[model samples]
Target: MRMSELSRRSGVSVPTIKYYLREGLLPAGRQLSATQAEYDENHLRRLRLIRALIGVRGLSVSTTREVLGALAEDTADTHRLLGLTLGAIQVAGETEPDSPEPAEVDALIEKLGWNVHGSAPARATLAETLASLRTLGSPLDWRVLLPYARLAEQTAVLDLDQLEGIEDPLEVAERALLLTVLLEPALMALRRMAQENESARRHADGTAD
Candidate 1:
């Protein structure tokens, strides 16, 4: 496809496509002339992935570039590929990088037998959230999280199920990114609705908090 066709198919303007090419977010097309190039399905897929990562997920251009770079490195292991793509996503809570690692967090992970990396962003997020709770005078027991962790484990299965049979690395990454980020609000809404239902069921009135 020509640049114009690529632009038409991608829903991106011609100038913006050129800008992506220059920024290294989108790969260069095959040279057709001194001033023209031809693109293909791979480019289209990658272009869409770039748009999702930047536009929908709100990743900066530099971060998007790093993600694209990670995608370029050939990896036969699907797990590693998924990890690379997932690492691009920054989970909401980020405390100081130099903050002390909480031992309770490690103990909780051990209790759950979760094979999470020490450097995982969610680890820091959990630690920070737990710390904040203590600072706010509602210190929670690490054991209290066990039930939620079990539920999260089940939920994680459902989350990974969304990626099944997605062969394209970019497509897998894009789907995972959208599902993980977009579903957060939906999950919160579900929790609120469930709480109301459960309250009414148990208390015979929704007014009982």
Candidate 2:
């Protein structure tokens, strides 16, 4: 397809596609002529993935470029590919690095027998959240997280199960990113609704503490 056709099919503006080409966010199509380039299905797929990551998931251009770089690496191992994607998605936070919180998180993961890597971004997020809880004087014991961990494990199974029929590595990467960034807000909203329902069931009758 020509640049016009590519832009039309991708639902992205021609100028934007040119910008992506220049920014190295989108790879250049085949050079059919000095003034013309031909794109293909892969280009279209990549364009959609770029739109989803940037428009829907709100990733910065650099982060999206890094994610695309990881996806382009020749790796069929889904887990490793997921690790690469996740590593790129870690936005900076207010918490300082290299704290004792990681050690406590490690012990809790050991107790739960989770297969989470020590260097996973989620591990750092968990550690930071726990540290904040302590700073706020409402620290939760490790035992209190057991049920939540089990629930998260079940959700993880569901997440991986959704990728079963997807064979394309790029599609898998896009799905993984969407599940984490796009669907997460929905999941959190559901959790809030569930909490409200539980509160009503337990405390609405005036016998609650």
RMSD (CA, Å), candidate 1 to true, equals 2.9
User: Which digits, one per residue and each the tens of the lDDT, describe model 2 over residues 1-209?
Assistant: 88899889978999999989999999899998899889998898899889878877788899889888877884577888887765667753345566566777787899988887756777777878988997898887777887899898899899999989998877887788888887889999999988887888887963445
State the weakest 10-residue window (summed lDDT) of model 2.
Answer: 91-100
- Can you list the residue pairs that collide in candidate 1? none
List ranges where model 2 is wrong by over 4 Å: 92-100, 205-209
RMSD of every prediction: 2.9, 3.2
lDDT for predicted candidate 1 compared with the true structure: 0.83
lDDT of 1 by residue, 1-209 (tens): 99899889988889988999999888899998999898999999898888888888898899989888877894466777777777657674755555443677888899999998888777877888987887788877778888999999999999999989988877887788788778988999999999889979888865655
Evaluate model 2: give its TM-score. 0.88
Please tell me which predicted candidate would have the highest TM-score against the true structure.
1
